[model samples]
Target: MPTPTRITPDSLRAAARTVLERDGRDGLTMQAVATALGVRAPSLYKHVRDRDDLVRVVVDDVSRELGDRLDVALADAGADAATAVRALAEVARRFAHEHPQGYALVFGPLPGSASPDRAALDHGAAALLEAARRLVGEEHALKAARTLTAWMHGFTSMELVGAFRLGGEVDAAWSYGLERIVAGLAADGRGRAG
Candidate 1:
């Protein structure tokens, strides 16, 4: 048999991602990752705190990626805040579709009292704050950020679960609902858009 390659933090993260993609959150395990890497289980302890910590890292990593994409993908909508908002919604929705497991991991419950792994989660939240600041003005950025986060979460959750009825055009409904949000925001976004 060939010799086993060493697993570094980068390789470990890559392996963990593969596990998440293949197994979803439920199927990933410490031993499984070790086995996949051809290493003993204790060897993983050097790289990951524990299973919960590992999951947190995974969530944080994915959160950073999603947040970056959402910002970049929608920020180019120009002066039209409504246009930018719609693009933002689409980015969130598309993330759910394209990365259901990662999306779920990012939004799902933590294993226990463990907080986010610091880097990814904090940076992602900060990026979100920045996005809200861009969408609305500084005064209402916090409130608007909360509103947008909740709305995007609700819409993305509904779309991912196929919870909507089969009879209507979901895209049209989403657009209409989003328009109402933009209209409401415009009362405020209008001031900034000027």
Candidate 2:
């Protein structure tokens, strides 16, 4: 007789994240997660509906974590809007680098039938929106947030896939891009104010 495993949803998520970080998206399987938790593959079905459900769970967890980190980074950023934006961007980049597979799972497109956890997604977006509001004010905050997210997604996605073949110092490039975006946002805010 085998010992009963005390697997909770939280533990499942942690195991899934571990598998994701270790094997990337293609390798994140129910069997892999169960093995990580020292349980039979069938045991996971008790907690999650299917592989899609598992992915969604991990996505929500990662999204909430990203939100928490962004909030912390912003809290330490003081009143300067550019500084806040820079802080937000840096945290996002760091998170992406740290958990590339999880980053893709959270930010990448999902299947038509699989919906993400709205509150978790909103939590992260709200942090960015608040930072954008500080930078560009109320009228343009959402757009600014979208622009920043898109830029980060594009750059990070490319970097993750080793797409920057002609790169001469990727770190410098990221800094240059962030600086230009910040300057542009500041100018836009000034224009709106004046």
Candidate 3:
């Protein structure tokens, strides 16, 4: 009998990501990854424990990629805190649009309490919070970060699933919303500091 093709955890995660991008959240399975890798389903177990494990790994990888993007977006904003916050939101929106399936996997359903991959998700959240803190003092950082994330996630989720039936430009709506958020934060920041 021929030896099974050797596969690393990275290779498995890559194949899983491809499956996610092509077939979406529902289509990610060991069999699918195996098929993508031209191997048997059982062969995947050598790298990942099971479907959930594969998902955890894929989500971590995706989150890490997102963190990298957020880092760049934050860095490019220079000394403007509000712009940095907006830039992070824009990056999240673009990431959702570009990787809808991957985005859904991470942001759609709530993970279990004991999930082992919280760090990856936290890393992304921390990036946002750090940027937000720079804009609105540490006391209001969490709320600011949550508000930005909620807006980005809500808009992106709706836009991705065709929830917007209006004929107007959605991108325009997105920009408008970001503008409002920045304005609100600025007002709040000034109000609290005065």
Best by TM-score: 2
Q: Rank the candidates by lDDT, best first.
A: 2, 3, 1
Using all chains and alpha carbons, the TM-scores for the candidates as numbered come to: 0.85, 0.96, 0.93
lDDT of 2 by residue, 1-194 (tens): 88887998789989999999999888989999999999889999999988988888888899999999999989999989999999999999999999999999888888755567899999988888998999899999999999999999999999999999995999999999999999999899989988
Candidate 2, residue 42: CA error in Å?
Answer: 1.4
**Candidate 1 local Cα displacement, residue 152, angstroms:** 1.3
Candidate 3 or 1, higher TM-score: 3
Sorted by TM-score (best first), the order is 2, 3, 1
**Which candidate number would show the highest lDDT if scored against the true structure?**
2
Candidate 3 contains a number of clashing pairs equal to 0
For candidate 1, write residues 12-55 as lDDT tens digits.
Answer: 87788788888878777898788778898898998888898778
Error of 1 at 124 (Å): 1.9
